[model samples]
Target: MKKWCDNAALLTLHGNTVGMVSKEFVVSAPGKIILHGEHAVVYGKLAVAAALSLRTTLHIKTIHDKDDVLLHLPDIGVEVGWSVPEIAAAVALPVCDPEKPAPPSEELLQKLKTFASIPHDSADTKTLALVSFLYLYCAIVGSQKTLTPLEIRIESKLPVSAGLGSSAAYSVCLAASLLLHKNLISASGKWSEKDLQLINAWAFQAEKVIHGKPSGIDNSVSTYGHAVSFTKGSEPVILSQVPSIRILLVNTKVPRSTKTLVESVKKKYDKSTVVMSAVMDTMEAVAKECLILFEKMYKGKADEYYKQLEELIYINQQQLDIIGVSHIALEKVIQITKANGLCSKLTGAGGGGCAFALIRPDVPKETLDCVIQQLSLEGFDCWETGIGAEGVTLHV
Candidate 1:
């Protein structure tokens, strides 16, 4: 077995005059994108997801005084404070056991919704985000020990509501920071695998607060980091090593409802069960083949694997269109990539949110530039981002 823990020092004394050095904690997690699965994964199909280079970070600093705990969330424009005693009073609100955190009670959810001034049935980004943070803070800090005045700030480079797993990154960072603050994990050393698993579990609970029935892929990948292959009813298989690839992620700027797209897929499957099942079966094969290729894609015979993966992307995109999740915005992205002799597909539940293009090593700079320019001209946000990045990490 390999050891994962590394020791980090805390509490440095600078002055001979003896001033207090505040304990500062920094934890960060990377976002994710589905590589070969979209709507098909909903009905028990294989999906491969990899970590994004983009990350969200949380900083926690303990103040010496007894002021309220302050939270600064500049990404979502939330800055608020609550006294430790005030949070303690929230004990009356139902909190599940930390070992097994269930969904927060409806009463608590409604209360939080009312407090955040968000309407019923639809949890706004800010509202759900705040509720999850508060719940985690209280459920962890409020339960174990007396709270101290601290300041927590969160920031992210990933675009929110663009299906890049922004929320999962945020939750993973939060869980790691709070756990370290509570001394549940080592602050300054490589984290043990057990420590990381605990972090992932707690973070998943936070996700539950935001999304009623999350697939757990986002938080799991954010916590574990790397390329993972997952199918419902099976544990996610994280590759020991993965190939790094550059992808052109384009945001169509067309807002679509995931639930609506899912329903549309359901309707299609219901209409042609036999044909759709065969499509799903083919998708499963593509994903499995890609998983094997990804293990050694960077090594030998790279061009062969790249071509096969591109074909898979094309087929998957066609299946997405057949299931009725494709949008005109997504089609335009595909067209732009095709014009440049590149391959692309919508990465998540589509109808128009985001599409990603593969930038193979053989792609000419002029073609890449032309494609990016064309996508940008059409009011799409494009980023050349890395895949298979590191997971949540701790800093002292």
Candidate 2:
């Protein structure tokens, strides 16, 4: 992954051309991991997250007309055109005119209303991803902001709704692109660590428009461009490098919806405090243990650290299984990986998306290849990728 840039500029047109087409900023966001906390994180439990190599990239080019805001996602072959008049008409609410400014706190609500009025489905994963970004861009610029016709095209290797945080990656990439286009970053130079944090926070806010209450782990890791320990209320804390920990991401492609899974979990939790409290308490302990393992590894106690981390991952996976997020394919992948001498578990929101395996440093490349082929034969989409990727960054 490349570093962020600030010297982005517009491509000059011929003398006769009136509009300046900016150099397209290709922004990319990475997939994520739920190292410790999964369901418990929703209730504000701590969780460790890492950026994955699988990423979503968005390409943005400014166009000329107010009615020509076009969005295209080539990977899924989705394209949409938005007219300015249509946006204005859709946003004119009964309580306030489209032409007038609303109060500060209500600003976000009004923008949300505009988002709801736009013809997009919360159920359509890719469309929700697109509209969330567009809504943020339009609202951040406000009514006085002039948008030259713009065309945005997204292409990704990340699978949709597959627990890889694909949609969050799309949202973060889109947010970074629009921010770069609007000159929201510091003018002095490349994006600083603080700038990346700001980007992640803003991206998390954008995702709330879609997910209703996202954990913020996905966007935070994606924006920071590296592995982090994310807690919803606190800032993401970066982790130091640990070479022995290698991650494998496997897709079950079961096509589960996160909302449905979350609702199911919520219902179960609401019905039984003893059961739910015990489960969440277990997850919280695992997160704390994982953190201790990381600290030990960083402080040169490698042997004990690996053992504790592996235990944490194994126990966490089982908890997710008991909570009803693990699918048969996920279990199969975990079994195969473990049989091949790797520590493996489920990643992301569970239900039926992706599983993760922590490979031993001594494991040969052939073993990894064999595991991938074995999974593929069983009709699983297997991918081996590294952790510790850079978060969201813009390419000029």
Write down the lDDT of every candidate, Cα atoms only.
0.79, 0.68
The global Cα lDDT (0 to 1) of model 1 is 0.79
Q: Model 1: which residue pairs collide?
A: 6-189, 6-190, 8-188
Model 1 CA deviation exceeding 4 Å by range: 1-22, 92-103, 106-122, 298-304
lDDT of 1 by residue, 1-396 (tens): 111112233222122222222356567899999988776687898899999988997777776565677788888777777766766565553355454555667887776566545676776666787788877776666555466667777889899999999999999988887776666665553788888887888899889888878888999899989878998888888774878878889999899899988888888899999999988887788788888888677667666677887888898888777777888999999998998899999988898899999888888889888999999999999988888888997654
Please report the TM-score between candidate 2 and the true structure: 0.78
Count of residue pairs whose backbone atoms collide, per candidate: 3, 4
Candidate 1 TM-score versus the reference: 0.89
The residue pairs in collision within model 2 are 63-149, 225-390, 225-391, 325-351
Q: Which ten residues in a row have the lowest lDDT in candidate 1?
A: 1-10
